[model samples]
Target: MHSAIDAATLRAYRDTHYRVRGDTPMTLRIDQPSPALAALHQVHGVDCSAFITAANPHSRRCGDDANARRQLALAQDLERMGLAAMAAAGEHPSNGWPAEPSFLVPGLSLHDARMLGEKYGQNAVVWSGADAVPRLVLLR
Candidate 1:
């Protein structure tokens, strides 16, 4: 079964686990969600929504080649959704300088973020907090 997470919990988690950064107005990444998560979105009237992830942007684990592959994969996913997305190599707010660039999407509301997390089976959802801090919500 799915569960809910409050804002305070999310905010604390982000502060403790990730390197939070200021909002990057023009950049974001949409990671591919699992099949169950995709199905949950459809049921919730989110016909097309991208699953965002929080990761250290400065990590070199993936390298240049892997980064390109991820971009290509995300492009394909967006295409399937019939949505236009742009990919760029830049420093993202939450992730830093990711090996793979992230797809730029509009900022979402807290409500939307929660819904996305609930459906995506995410352990948590991270977004820019009111004071510009990175906030998170643990999902179980």
Candidate 2:
């Protein structure tokens, strides 16, 4: 029964992800790129694309809330590091791969993301599906 909306706790949760993954400069994935990431790319300088699959084609149509917010945070984190992201979109899970991230950031690995989602956790998780492994490329 986490609050899922406390800023202080949220920061701690996000920090935990970095801690477990290590702060080293590494590439990470958002499992599924969201509108926020798209906005970052369009204006904030993120280079994220969309991750499509046979089950979920037409990346736009596959857009979900959980994935979108994760992508947004990831884009924001990458922006802090001055890294550019590209939205990965395609018809195959492996088709639009943007390089295996140093750390794969997915809601499936919610031990950390969930903690980070203390203030924004949702039933619509970003990495709960069999094909949900979209991540952010933490370009070096």
Local distance difference test, candidate 2: 0.31
Tens-digit lDDT string for candidate 2 (41-132): 34533233222211112122333554555556656654554444344322123334222111223222334333333323232112222332
Cα-based lDDT for every prediction: 0.40, 0.31
Best by TM-score: 1
TM-score of 1: 0.36
Q: For all the candidates, what are their Cα RMSDs to the real structure? A: 11.4, 15.5
TM-score of 2: 0.24
lDDT of 1 by residue, 1-140 (tens): 34354554333343332221233222222231234333433444443333243222222255666556655655664566565443333333453334324443223445655654454334655444223333334456
